[model samples]
Every structure is written in C-alpha cells, then in structure tokens.
Target: MVLCAGASQPPQSSQTLLAGVGDSSRASLSSGNEGGRYELTPERRALLNTIRYAEGTWKDGEDKGYQIMYGGGQFQDLSRHPERVIVKRYTSAAAGAYQFLPKTWKGVAQELRLSSFEPRHQDQAALHLAERRGALDEIDRQGLTKDAMAKLAPEWASFPTKAGHSAYGQPVKSHQELASFYSSNLRQLRNQLGA
Candidate 1:
C-alpha cells in the first residue's frame, strides 16, 4: 500500500487494516524529534538510506518507493498513505523500509510508539534491528564485515554476500554490483563520520 511521497493513491474506502497514524512516533532520524530515542548523525542517516535503497520497496510484493514499511498484524505495508485502506491476508507481512514482520514490528513499534510506519519510524526500527545484530557497533567503528552481514542476513535481505548467490534474494543484482553498492555507500558514510 506504500506510495511514493506525493503520489496519489487509491482513495480510502471500506477496507480496514492499517492502524491509524498519530503523532505517536517517539524518536526519529532528524534532530530533536520530540521524544525520539537517538538523533542520527548525517552520516548514519545516509548509510541507512543506502541500505533501504538496496532493499527496495514492497507493497503486497510490489516495488513502490525507497522508504517502505509493513505491518504484519494487518499484512499491509505501513508506509502506505494514512487514508489508504487495505486488507491483505498474508500469514506474515513485513513493515517499514526495513521489512519487519508482524512480531518484529510489534516490539519495535511499541518501543517507538509509532503513529505510522513512516520513514522515521522505519529508520528507528532498522536501527534497533542493527543493534540486535551487532552491526551498530561495527558501523560505529566504520567496519562492516561479511561476517556481520551474514549474522544479520536473517534480518536484512540485502546485506552483502560472498560467492555470488546466483539467483537468490529479491531484486537480484550481480555480486559485483552488490559489492560496489555496499562498499561505496559504507565508505561515504565512514568519511562523513570521520571514522
């Protein structure tokens, strides 16, 4: 149900699923988001944007935008327009730009008190996922590793991989392409952080 910002979506109708948005997001990427957990440095935000870009978007399994989120409880992409009503019967649905399943979203969304699965809430949820995977510490050190990527693979579908996957994950690209994408983005973020 995600729509690229400014794009008009199907008008809201009788279908019901997504939780209504409120000013409930506690923390966000930008500085001084009222009640936000952490203020991301420009470098960190850039890195996250790169990761989301690589991941692409999903709306009931369709690409829509760079920043996307899903709500598993309703099997809807939470990044959808607030007024956009959808009711898909997927056993599981991934939410946010990070593709978090319902169980995962519940925890993350609760902690953040997310009013909507907007990009900011999605970023916070991804940060929490990264922290759980030990990537946050490595990212802070400006050292992203294949090992770290592997450890986090079960979470992030697009983490860099070795020995070209042939044709595995969604939005398939060449191993070389993936490597270049990851390395260039990581380098840029590190430089920005002066790390």
Candidate 2:
C-alpha cells in the first residue's frame, strides 16, 4: 500500500467527514449521501471553535498559547470530539521539525514557519497530484489491468480526486486531456487555498 506522509486515517463517525469544508476557522459539517444533509450541532460547533483557535494560535507562532490551548491532553483526545478532526489533520500535516518564518512575518529572529506558503505550496500540491495521476495512467497504458493496478497501489482507492470521483470514471482522451484536468483542478484549488 502506498502511504502518504500525513494522510489521516479515515474517521469512523459521521462528523469526521466535515473536516474538508470551510476555512480552518469555521467549517460546516454535512451528513447523508448527497441531497440529505444537516449542519453541525451547537456542541460540535464549540468543539470546532476550540480546534480552530488552537490552530490559529499555532499558525501565529504562539507556541505557549498553542500548548496551553491543546496541551492538556486535548490533542490526543480527538476521538471524544470528532469535530476536531480538521485540527488533527492540520496538526498532523505540521508534524515534522523543519522551521522557518512565514512569508508575511518579518523582523522576527528565530521564528518558526508553518507550511502555508501561497502560490508555491498550492502549485506543488497540484504538480504532485498531477504526477500521481500521470503515473497511474502510464500503468494503465502499459497493459496493467484494473486488478493489477489495485494490487500495485491499494492506497489509490482512497486518493482524493476532483469531486471525489476517479479519473478513470472521468475518462481521458490523451495526455493532453490529463494535462487539462491538472491545470483546471490546480487553478480551482489554488484559488481556494488563497481564500
């Protein structure tokens, strides 16, 4: 199985799915398959707010504040408050020890940088996703059957695709088609990342 460095294990509760919506500060959770959905409850909202505040504190370089907000064993207790899954995801993404100042912050010596660079980070994510898709396509073109492909990269079953659908489902006409898909999705995601 191909393992991503920081991919969170899929959550068990319905509330865990809400992590993908909205900005880091405010996220609305939804339920049901498609049409039927509902907003998160007040309790869930409170928990989400705590998580967001903790994230903001960490991102703003307030290490003490972040620790105070989350250090009381709260970070590891996310299962009790499933709404904090987004916070968990963010924290997990920042797990490594590399540190530098954020682009916006200057004149602060010895500041640690969080991984939120604007266009560059967005572009890198887009390129990485595109390359993965290209590799998958190459596998297919080289006569690897669906079963073989699955065996090769079992984790592909969980790889996030545009609108949560596989590229094969969308069907590619050529390499140009794949390039087009990458460009379009990259543009959309870059916009979202900026906002």
Candidate 3:
C-alpha cells in the first residue's frame, strides 16, 4: 500500500494537509476561531494523512471492492451517542449490474462478504442469505432471553417464506422481518436445546 500527502498553498497563518492516492483525496485544515489559519502539528498532520490515504485505497477499487466508513461525534452537551458505522460491499461482474451489501450498527463490528458465482443473480441471493444467518447469530450471541424470543414468534410465523420452502427467504425487507424470522427460529432452536 502506498501513502502520500500534499496540500494546496496554505494561507499565510493557517495550514492544510492533503492526503490521497490517484484521483481520490481528503483535506484537513487548522484555523483559529477568528479565521486565522494554523499549521497542523506534525503528529496531527501525519494522522490525518494516514486516514486520507486509507480512504483513497478503498476508493481506488470503487465498484469492485468493499468500503467501510466509521466514526463518532459528541453532542454539545457531551453526552456520548454510540459510535455509528456503515459497511458497503460492491461487485460488478455482470454488465450493467452491481450488488450492494450495507449494514449499520452501533458498538459492534460491521461485517460484509462478497463472492462471485456463475450467475450474478444467484450470487446476490447468496449474499442476502448470509446476512440473514448473521443476524440470527447475533441474536444468539446477545443472549436474548427465551421469553423475549417466544413473544416474537407468532408474528414471525406470518412472514412470507420462499414459495414452497419452509425456511425464511432471501432479502428480508425490514428489521421487523429479520427480527421476526430470528425470533421464530429461536423458538425452534430453544426447544431443541431444551432451554
């Protein structure tokens, strides 16, 4: 991985750091409240440059690879909202085609995976299936009580399964759908486990 940094002409009193690779770029600026610019300290500039370079690397593979953006900010009152992050995976093996896998959540690592199949549509279907399986794993790992899972079962039962199939289908359309699917499945799993 190559990393480079540069900047346009800095203002007489302010400094700017430019970080990027090829056609992708990011800029960081340091200025006083009065609008007087200040040069970034070497340490701060290096950090900004590193981040910019990383973003550039991802952008280089635009439409062919995965990109994730994550960060956090505070309200003026200093109460911390959980950090937010989004992951997007893109693939364009077929003409005029692309697949997108996006997930956003707080306090947990966002995961994404991509694969190429002989038929692009099948690949897309598989990706959606994997995402649903992942959600079920999360519910299990979070130690959701059996009662809570049970309470959600009836609604889960009403979800539209794939035509002629007994299991949930690809592309659950909403969080409610995913939750219901997991809840329904959990009830079955709990019984098997005698929980």
Please, what are the lDDT tens digits per residue for candidate 3 over residues 45-161? Answer: 222222222222122212221222221111121122122332323121111011121221111112212222112222223223323434223333453233322322221221223
- Candidate 1, pairs of clashing residues: 26-35, 27-36, 68-96, 68-97, 69-95, 69-96, 70-94, 70-95, 70-96
Give me the candidate number with maximum lDDT: 1
Candidate 2 on 1-195: residue-level lDDT in tens?
A: 111222222212223223223343132222211111212322222222222221222222122222222112223221111122123322322210011112211211113221433212221222233234354344323422333223223223223344433332321122232233323333333343453
Clash number by candidate, in order: 9, 1, 3
lDDT of each: 0.45, 0.25, 0.23
Q: What are the runs in model 3 whose C-alpha is more than 4 Å off? A: 1-172
Clash list (residue pairs), candidate 3: 13-37, 14-37, 14-38
Candidate 3, which ten residues in sequence have the lowest lDDT sum? Answer: 1-10
User: Which scores higher on lDDT, 2 or 3?
Assistant: 2
Q: List the residue pairs that clash in candidate 2.
A: 100-113
Residue 40, candidate 3: alpha-carbon lDDT: 28
